[model samples]
Target: MSDTDKKTVIVFTDGACSGNPGPGGWGALLQWNGQEKEITGGAPDTTNNRMEMRAVIEALNALNQPCHVKIHSDSALIVNAFKQGWVDGWLKRGWKKTNKKPVENRDLWEEMLTAMQPHDVEWIKVKGHSDNERNNRVDRLAVEASRKFQQS
Candidate 1:
C-alpha cells in the first residue's frame, strides 16, 4: 500500500525494572497496515515509571508521519494520568503537583507530547499478562533489556 494509505497505527509498550530504582528498560512495537517495527532500550539505573514514560515517548518519536495512533500500555500510573486528564492539570500547573513538588518524569512527558503533536493519538490501558500478543512480546523484550543491563 502507499504511504497515504497507512493512516492508522497500533503501538504496544512496556517497561521493566530490576528494582524500583535499579536497572530499567523499555520496549515498544508499532504496527501499521501489514508492517511491524520493534524498539527496545535500557538504562543502567532508573525507575520503572521513567522507563514506562520512555516507552511511549520512543514509540511516538519513531513514526515517520502523522497518523492516527493507538498506544497501549500496562502502567496504570502512565495510563491513568493521560486517560483521566490528570496530565492536562499537571501541564497547566507548570508540571507541579498541587502540593507544589515538581512532577516526576516531566522530561519524558514533554517528549511524549512533542512526539504526539503531529498525530491523533489515543491511549489505552491493557492488562499486562493476558491475551495480548504484542503486549507480551514487548514485555519480554523489556525484561530482556533490563536483564542485559544487570549482566553488565
Candidate 2:
C-alpha cells in the first residue's frame, strides 16, 4: 500500500473452464464506498489459469483511478506469483521459468502487470468451493459466462 490517500477498493475474482483448453470465462466483483460492480468475459478456447489471471486483469482495468486494491481470488498460482516474488523472478529471466521453459500465459501476465501499475495491490488467496459468498458469486458468474461457449 503506497499511498494512504488512495481510496480502498475490494475486489473478488474467479475463473472457470469447461475443459482444460476449452471454453473459459472470468468474473470480477468490485466494491468501493458501499457500491458494487460486476464484470465478466469469456474466451472460446483457453486455459483455467489464463481465465483466472484475466479476472484480475479486468478488475484492475475497471478502476478509473489509482487506488489501494485488495484482490480476493481462489487461485494460489495467481496469488503466489505476486505475493511470493514469482513475477519479479520471471521478469528478471525474460518470462522464462526456472527450467528455461517459456512461461505459460505470458501475454496475460504482461497485461496484468500493466493493469496493476497504477494501484497499490494486494493479492489474497481464498479457499475455492468454500463458504466465501462473494467468491462463490464470482465463480458462478464465471461458470455462467463459460456456459455460452460450452454450447457452441
Per-model TM values vs. the true structure: 0.92, 0.97
**Tens digit per residue, CA lDDT, model 1, 29-139:** 999879999999999999999998899989989988888889999999888888898889998999998788999988888888899888888889999988998899999
lDDT of 2 at 112: 95
Model 1 misplaced stretches (Cα beyond 4 Å): 1-6
Task: List per-prediction Cα lDDT, in the order shown.
Answer: 0.90, 0.95
Off by over 4 Å in 2: none
What is the alpha-carbon lDDT for the whole of candidate 1?
Answer: 0.90
Winning candidate number (TM-score):
2
> What C-alpha lDDT, on a 0 to 100 scale, does residue 47 get in candidate 2?
88
Q: For residues 20-111, could you state the per-residue lDDT of candidate 2 as single tens digits?
A: 99999999999999999999999999989989999999999999999999999999999999999998999999999999999898999999
**Top-lDDT candidate index:** 2
